[model samples]
Target: MTDTILEVRDLRTSFFTENFEVKAVDGVNFSVPKGKTLGVVGESGSGKSITSLSILRLIQNPGKVVGGQVLFKGEDLLEKSEAQMRKIRGNKISMIFQEPMTSLNPVYTVGQQIGEAFQIHEKLNKKESIKRSVRC
Candidate 1:
């Protein structure tokens, strides 16, 4: 089996701002092998977030994944439907944002928020999810 867990080739993302089209990710390429981490380091407006959003197919209106092949586990994620992509997003591939405080909901308790991940991905019962979360 191939060692690559995720591969992004010639990935491109663009946004239309009234005046012109801005290419956030311009033909970027990288691969992450299994059991390894890939760090994207750059200044703001460097297309780091856009690249992740495209991988997740989470780009909003006026912004689009113009071109790319995002292969996860040998599957072409870019070619998958939204519903199909959703299944892979939090389950097969998970991401922790740079700022956990902002990523989390302030109103909910930490346990409650963490339990939601189990509920969504594992479909675990609330009690069991909470128990599992506490162990973490």
Candidate 2:
């Protein structure tokens, strides 16, 4: 059996404004197997970013996920509470922003920033986190 790591089903997200509503994402679906890579590609404004944001439950005010199921390891992320999602983000799943300059902190080195995840999720010390960060 192919081990399915992540699956997205019928995701729908919309932005609400006083004037009108914009359907940013609608009826998106995909699956990623374990130890595999999935790339999202589309023209600009084709709901690529919106679909990703909806999967991560990162849609902010004026925008909402209308429908969908985001399953990670067979667990429904769309049903998870905010606190639960916090534990999953970065630890279980992560997104590399398209622009590194904006995503990365100016003061910290790349290793320090990457190692921070190990410190938080794996409970490793600064020394160990830095050590592990460089190995990859």
Candidate 3:
């Protein structure tokens, strides 16, 4: 059987605005075993994306992972330094942003934007990945 590659325990992410606090992700727990895939499904604003952002330590200003732990290969990612996280971010771990178009450059075609993404994790050249993306 495959071992647990990633586990999240009681993850809570919060956003603070002038008016009040929004608990985007609260008390979330899950695990992904090696050689396995997990799917998270819920209605909009149900904190699905927020939980992922927290696990990746990509929570931005006004939003923070207030509590809980993200364990990757038995190492607590929450305890890792930013430099350590940086190394892990591109190599050991990665993410696919939810919206493709929002960040796509207006002048570039969708294939061009997606090709850059393949360059990131898949290590394909712009020409090859762009061709692959366009075909898809």
Best by TM-score: 2
Residue 51 lDDT (model 3) = 86
Candidate 1 backbone collisions, by pair: none
Q: Candidate 2 on 4-75: residue-level lDDT in tens? A: 999999999999999998999989999999999999889999999888888888999899999989988998
**2 against 3, candidate with superior lDDT:** 2
lDDT of 3 by residue, 1-136 (tens): 3499999999999999999989899899999999899999999989888888888898998998899999999899999999888778846776877776774578988678767656776789889989878776
Instruction: Show where candidate 1 strays beyond 4 Å.
Output: 98-102
Q: Which residue window of length 10 is worst by lDDT in model 3?
A: 96-105
Instruction: Estimate candidate 1's alpha-carbon lDDT, on a 0 to 1 scale.
Output: 0.88
- The TM-score that candidate 1 achieves is 0.90
lDDT tens readout by residue for model 1, 69-130: 99999888989988997788767877666677899888988888788888898999888889
* lDDT of the candidates, in the order given: 0.88, 0.90, 0.85
Better model by TM-score: candidate 1 vs candidate 2: 2
**Model 2 misplaced regions, further than 4 Å:** none
TM-score pick, better of 2 and 3:
2
